[model samples]
Target: MIAIDNILVSDDVVREQFVCDLAKCKGGCCEDGDAGAPLEKGELDEINAIYDIVKPYLTPAGIKEIETRGRYQYDREFGWVTPTIEGKMCAYGYRDEKGVIKCGIEQAYYDGKTSWKKPISCHLYPIKISMTKEGEVVNYEPRETMCRPGCIQGKKLKVPVYVFLKEALIRKYGEDFYGVLEQVAGSYFAKAEKQNK
Candidate 1:
């Protein structure tokens, strides 16, 4: 693990490869989970504030689910989560013509309806944050069954998990922290290359 400020980053994030293949997965992560998208405490407020703007883009089913579920809920395992439709697709999800699940919140953001781009948790997917006695521990979740296509694509593109998640990492931790992480990853990979040779 590498420590930067208060965050502990797992080495797997550097060693592993991943890239979301929306065509193959069709945004399955948003629909296949037991619960809805995870949310930070502050995100609740944004959901409420942006619901009006996002509502227009959402499907009728999504709108109904949101109206009934009250935007967010507490899960036994995930704690705070966005409500799901009958424990399936997120209340904020819509399907495109190709049947790819799309985030209504993100659609609104792209449409210039809201400044806050969906939940940070959603943006930083496949990487989950857990609170330890020491600090926040960031780990790459290996949901291989769900993300096989991404794994294949990542290997083909030579994109490590850290590189694939660069934008989200920078969003969660500042650019300086991400830069430091990049340096650490470079050193780690370089050392591995030397040992392998």
Candidate 2:
């Protein structure tokens, strides 16, 4: 594990290559999960504050779900999460013209209707974060079947997971943390290469 401040990052985060192939996956991550996207406590307020502005970007069904159940719901296993549409897709997501599921909140952000993007968990996907007794533990956990195209694409393009998720990482842990992670990754990969040689 690579220690960055209090967060313990799995080595696979630096070693594994991954770049989302949206065309192939069709944003399955948004629709396939059992529960809706995990939400941080502070994000609940953000979602509530922006719901009105973001409503237009969502599907009618999604809007209904949100209105009926409130902005966010509590889950026994996952604590706070965005509500799902009848246990299917996230209520905050809608199918685009291409039939690909997309985050309505993100669309609203892109349209400048709202300043906040989607949840941080959704932004930093394939990297699951869990709070441990010590600190936050970050792990690389790509969906085996759903992420096949991404895996192939990443390997072909030679983009490591850390590099692919640079923006999200910076957003989550600040630029300084990411800078240290990049340095650590460089040194780790170089040492591995030398050993292989």
**Candidate 2 TM-score versus the reference:** 0.98
Measured by lDDT, the strongest candidate is 2
For model 2, residues 1-197, the per-residue Cα lDDT tens digits are 99988899999999999999999999999988878899999998999799889988888899899889989999999989999989999998988778788999999999888888889999999999999998999999999999999999999999999999999999999999999999999999999999999
- Candidate 1, residues 13-106, lDDT tens digits: the string is 9999998999989999888887888888888898888888888898888788878768899999998999888889988898999989999899
Q: Could you tell me which residue pairs clash in candidate 2? A: none
* Candidate 2, lDDT over the whole model: 0.92
**What TM-score against the true fold does each predicted structure earn?**
0.96, 0.98
lDDT of each: 0.89, 0.92
What residue runs in model 1 are displaced by over 4 Å at the alpha carbon? Answer: none
Poorest 10 consecutive residues by lDDT, candidate 1 = 140-149
